[model samples]
Target chain A: MRLARVIGTVVATRKEESLIGFKLLVIEEMDPREERPTNNRLVAVDTLGAGEGDVVLWVQGGAARVISEEHRKAPLDVAIVGIIDAVDIADE
Target chain B: MRLARVIGTVVATRKEESLIGFKLLVIEEMDPREERPTNNRLVAVDTLGAGEGDVVLWVQGGAARVISEEHRKAPLDVAIVGIIDAVDIADE
Candidate 1:
């Protein structure tokens, strides 16, 4: 998983049926140490009740479908799995 | 999903039971245009018969579980979903 900051939310009225109750958030990748925003941005399903400005841990691909029990068959490509508490990288 | 190159394979004798028949490969993230490797490396389950030196499209998180019918309950965090055939980025 990687660290990302939730920047905004996506409001889609007509989407896949399985994704009905999920909250979609726009996230920007962040540098591990400095927490600076990277150029990559993606819309991710928020499974952990994360909101804008929260640092989250996201998972991408098919695994995103299994994060929530209700959306087991959702056609989702990205999902926020956890809200990051802290990160400590040991110097090499 | 993101593009990555299969660099090496991982072998473990004792691991999660659900991952027994799956092949684990070490993948290096690549730039979309240049295909140059970035500073990330991950061990991902190969579901689409990808081999070393192949460029693949990989997905991470819980969504990876539903890629194959057999390993749906496996404790996998990353998986290669497709062997990339081509990537064409339209000029702005």
Candidate 2:
């Protein structure tokens, strides 16, 4: 999974039948330092009630298919599965 | 799976019931180009015990749950499944 922040929402009227009920979010890649965001952006399937400005955890590829159980042909390369409130990084 | 190094670890106190004893790692997302680290990072479930600077392969979504078989409500989107010493991206 990667760290990303939901920047916007994607509206796709024509999509796969399996993806009809799933929400799509436009996420801007983020730095692990929790600094500024990056230029790259990705569209991900959201199932955890994430919204714009929320830091989220997203999965990609076959792993995504296993989570949402939808969007067989929805053309998504990423999926948001969780909303992260805090991270403790001192005990690595 | 993407290439990443274990930069640190995460410890959550009030986590979901299913994630009582799982280990989480702080990962830095690397550019596929292998250029200098992109300054991007992630927190992932570590089943392989990857150490700092070890490039690892991670699974997300249900694939992660199937691999770790824990964290039923732990809200993890990334799980480190294999430790990668090298990658031959030339074939991609």
Candidate 3:
């Protein structure tokens, strides 16, 4: 999983039926070290109820369908799975 | 889902039991437009029998757990869900 920070929310009235109750949030990709922002912003399905400015653990791809059985058929590519409490990188 | 190319395979003799039969592959992230390699290479669980040099659609997160009921508890974060036949991008 990659680290991200919830930046904003997305409001889509017309979307896939399976995505009806999911909260979509705009997330900024963060570098593993230092938590710096990198890459493009992505809209992700928030499964952990992450709020704006919260650091989250997000996953991409078909694994996104595992968020819930009801979301199995949703055309979702990304989803926030966890809220990070802390990140400690150990030197190798 | 993001585009990627299977570059190689990974061998983990000691891993989670749920991942016992899954094929682990090294994938190179590609740009959605031209399919050029970008960012970093990631190790993904292949579900569609994608071979080396094949392009695929991959997902990351708990949703990856939805690949199969048996894999619901696997400690996997990334998974290749589909083999891409073609990607057509229309000018917006």
Candidate 4:
């Protein structure tokens, strides 16, 4: 899982059939080493109901599809699986 | 497919069982909108015969694992699929 902060929401009236009842959000990748957001922004399905400004743990690729069986057959590549409560890293 | 430039090769003597005979490479994402390499540097399994400095197309997720039956059950997240011959874009 990677860290990111939800930046905004995507409002698509029509999208892939598998994404029928999901929330698409804009998220900026969090570089924990640098402790900031990187330029790798992406759209992800919100499965945990994360709100804007919330730091989250996201999964990409095949695991993303596994989150929802319907998604497993879809072309989705990213998904928000958890809302982060905290992050602890050792500099050593 | 996404565009990226192979920066170099990775020398890992020991790795996952599925990647036994594959070459691991370092690639920097090519942000065509900015017309430069972004800070998204990643390590990917090379399926094609791509050399350093070569611009290539990479795939992420389950599609990555589909390249090889051995990789189908592995935890691999990325793979280099093609070495680009050229790219064309028009400014609107």
Top TM-score: which candidate number?
A: 2
Task: Kindly list the per-residue Cα lDDT of model 1 for residues A1-92, writing each as its tens digit.
Answer: 78888776544443334456876666778888887878676667776788777889987665676665665765467778889899898887
Instruction: List ranges where model 2 is wrong by over 4 Å.
Output: A71-75, A90-92, B1-5, B10-22, B29-40, B49-92
Query: For residues B10-82, what per-residue lDDT tens digits would candidate 3 score against the true structure?
Result: 8999987878988899999876544588877999987667899987766667646655666577888787765
Given candidate 3, what's the lDDT at residue A52?
A: 78
Q: Which 10 residues in a row give candidate 4 chain A its minimum summed lDDT?
A: A83-92
Query: B1-92, model 1: which lDDT tens digit per residue?
Result: 56689999988999988889899999998765455888889999885678899877665666566555665778887877656555543232
TM-score of chain B of each: 0.92, 0.79, 0.92, 0.89
Clashing pairs in 1: A60-B60, A62-B63, A62-B64, A63-B62, A63-B63, A63-B64, A64-B63
Residue B76's lDDT in candidate 1: 81
Candidate 4 lDDT, A7-92, residue by residue in tens: 99889887777678888999998864344987789999885678899877565777566544566777888877556554443222
| Residue-wise C-alpha lDDT for candidate 2, range A28-88, written one tens digit per residue | 9776665468787988887667888987766676556554335445566677755666654
Which 10 consecutive positions of candidate 1 chain A have the poorest summed lDDT? Answer: A10-19
TM-score of each: 0.56, 0.63, 0.56, 0.52
Worst 10 residues of 2 chain A by lDDT: A65-74
Model 4, span B1-92: residue lDDT tens: 78888776544333333345766666778976665887776656786888778889998767777876766754456788898887887887
Q: List the residue pairs that clash in candidate 2.
A: A32-B41, A92-B9
